[model samples]
Target: MVSFKEIKNDLPAGIVVFLVAVPLCLGIAMASGAPLFSGIIAGFVGGIVVTLISGSQLGVSGPAAGLAVIVLHAIEGLGSYEVFLSAVVLAGAFQLALGFLKAGSIGYYFPSSVIKGMLSGIGVIIILKQIPHAFGYDESYEGSLHFMEPDGKTTFSLLFDAIRYVSPAAVIISGLSLAILIFWEQILSKKGKIFQIIQGPLVVVILGIVLNLLFLNVYPEMALSANHLVELPVADSLGGFFQQFTAPDFSRVLTYEVLFLAGTLAIVASLETLLCLEATDKLDPYKRISPANRELKAQGVGNIVSGLLGGLPVTQVIVRSSANIQSGGRTKLSALIHGVLILGSVIAIPGLLNMIPLASLAAILIVVGYKLAKPALFKSMYRGGWNQFLPFVVTVLAIVFTDLLTGIGIGMVVGIFFILKNSYHVSHTMLTEKTPAGKEKYRMVLAEEVTFLNKGNIMQTLRKIPANAELEIDMSRSAVVDPDVRELIEDYKNTARSNNIKLSIKETAEDEKLEYEGMKF
Candidate 1:
């Protein structure tokens, strides 16, 4: 259950999140090649519907940038966007089943180091992805998360194009917007509550619109073109606005392609949502723990509503969630209010929103990205030592060079390797002594839980045990031993007599017998 406290903080935070979310929603829809209304619908459901169902106070759900490519290809393969909506509906049902089945525990397995890496990696990508837009290059769709694009343009190439064909008007607006955001956040904001209440992102957007309008009237040549400004589909009447929403094509709902794609959507959307949920909780200042199962259920319902309403799949989104936290949101009210603000704006002030420049939004995201990938964060991670640092750096690199999911998978593999290495290298302890007659004696104390991963280290220790010695294998503390490890010890025991060594096995009392794979030893 969410509390209703902190209206002062959450109100401003909600406004900030709403400002940041609008452009992203449109950009993601554009990137997916879907109707512009689809992104807005997903964002709406994620905020209004998901927030009501989710246990997380800070997590913000919406159409995700990570899903842009998958959605793009799926729409193409399904022959029509309406047909794809059926798959999304099925995917939502699948996620709902997963939630009820308690599969949300999968989120607990993500290592902290890898999670931090994902955050930093995404931060870097956000900045890189927004750079071209800041310079007025709109060829690469907004919310494009991958390095490679459908148009055969890489992130760097687009950046180069931005530099080569720079728009002076965009640069001026983005630069000034960046300055104001920094000024408000750094200097003026510390002065009074008014600064925090007004919020820099809102101020930036308004100033951005006003500046562009001034340019249009005074310096006509310097004004941004329609391509550079927001391009939401305008409607003449309330009925026309309602007409924008498309219902799913249920006739093809049972097709194999639809089912397969539905499964794909369920798995990918759920994975992304779980990952974002984990990251959001970690970022929460109060350190509140959210119920993962409940979050999955919320996301499930959000996607179902989104699909039925002709929107994209919904997931908990890190970028908007981080914005909420950074903006000082304290409860789920911020998310709910942001959804309400989204609704109000679309109905009353979309024309005002359409006047805002994309460059100003880019500046806001750049600032958010900078905070997420601060140099100090890297320094702190490096101080955590190689086990943590290696995975962190690898994840950042993989995200920048590859894509989000693949990068996370690569980072997880690296983190798991170090875990196994620790198990293999230090799975036991050995104590050396001398018997009364001066014959060497050795006691190898096994770890509480020894698996096949420790086989090599245990075997090496046995091979080095000298002849004419007394060796004791201690299993008193061991709870479970893998068959491979137990068998290796048994083989060493068999050869002890030939080596002129006496061997003894120390097990726990009969009441607490040593546990071996599938049996008691």
Candidate 2:
């Protein structure tokens, strides 16, 4: 069933995605307060295991930045990293149940405003967290998403601290890396087939290793310290490499706290995967629609394998999926190949990988972050109107100040408020007209559906009707009217008679024309 043409298209794309994923996996693991190797393991499981079962052709799964905050706290609260692994296992089981129950449709309920806000919020967090790493300040965690740092400094304050302790060597490497990345993307990448095959991030990383090595040899004083470089765990033999894999501790599986955390992870991961699935499908060149339920099932299996192998929790990451698309990945083979490459590199040349400096990776992420939170996106959202812009801005701010889940919660609330306001305003259309006889006539046209959300507006409209005026209540277009609204109409009818106002009701065949004169509740 496999074709050579497909491989030709996918292999190069896979290599590009692999290049993009390596540093992200390592950085996210560092951010989550987990062992660095666990990130690679998760990337392996996400690519090799999940891609095999996923319905999505281009969605690449890996450790997500959105989960970094939760993972950090879960590890701290659970008392050990292994216990958190147990929670991840349980979370996979939860996802499996969700898939079986066909709960993947829940993602459809989230507004586009909220989703965009989430993306922008995560982008801002990525840029803020990577600043110190970019300048070669390695005191803080590499992938942290929180504003408050473990060193008693806030995210903004850390910038000042990083400047005070700036490393000139790191600055130079990062500057050159960024320049190369920009040059490759803007000029060389468009000029030839070779540039298309060779990714800019890959070139930047390789060049960074070479430059740092040069600094070490030519100017010993400018050489970066070990802390400024990647630190992959080395294994001398195949058996020693196998020793790196860790299993989850099952002793904490029955604890209520563990179960609660597991449920939390499951809900969050599932939502994130579904959102990414929707986003990735939009970016597909063929406009392919991935099956949400199947994707959930695949993610559940991936997390189970990852947790068993001492990996962090996995989700469909938008960043990697977008990279896969941009790199011309045509199928799941690209993701699978990337995973195999990760395994091979770790096994064969981890020493070479270790030569990479954190500054180069930081430069790569800063570019990624800027793409996510581009100024044009904000301006476009603002032009869409207040109904769209309010929730978007609020979600971005909340996620920046708080955490992901909390920010989403706040955004959802704001989105709901806007929905309620629109519902109230759209319940009916009121018009006043003057006839040739100099008599005033009022017409109130009910909307297609009137629910309790329109109660206040309906009451306000009724109260504003002038006494002794002609009024017509129209419902011919309405398909459904709430019982509360019916009661309000009945009360208005009685009040109309008492106020000596002319009142008439127009109804459709679907509506009940109730005679409520002198009717008791």
Candidate 2: deviation at residue 209, Å?
Answer: 1.2
lDDT of 1 by residue, 1-521 (tens): 55677889899899889888988899899889899999998988898999999999999989999999899999999889999998998999999999999999999898898999999998998899889889998777877678898888898988999998778889999999999999999998999989988888888888889989999999999899988987777788899889989999988888898999999999999998999999999999999998988888888898899999999999999999999999889999999988888777887788888898989989989999998899998999999999999999998899888888989999999999999988898779999999999989888999999999999999899999988788888888899989998889777765786777778777774544232221112
Candidate lDDT values, in order: 0.89, 0.85
TM-score between candidate 1 and the true structure = 0.96
Best by TM-score: 1
Work out how many backbone clashes candidate 2 has.
Answer: 0
Clashes of 1: 0
Instruction: Rate residue 170 of model 2 by lDDT.
Output: 91
Clashing pairs for model 2 are none
Name the lDDT value of residue 259 in candidate 1: 93
Model 2 worst lDDT run, 10 consecutive residues? 512-521
Q: Write the per-residue lDDT of candidate 2 for residues 1-521, one digit (tens) a residue.
A: 22346776688778877777887788789888898889999998998999998999999998987799789888988889989999999899899888989988888888888888887887788788778877988777666666777556888888888899888889998899889878888899899978877777778788889889999999988988988987777899999998888889989799998999999999999998998888788768999989899889999999999999999999999878877876678888899999999889999989887888889888877777777788999999999999899999999999888877788889999999999999989999999997666667688899999999998999999899876677788889999999999899877988887766677787875666443332223
Give the residue spans of candidate 2 off by over 4 A: 1-9, 326-328, 435-437, 509-521
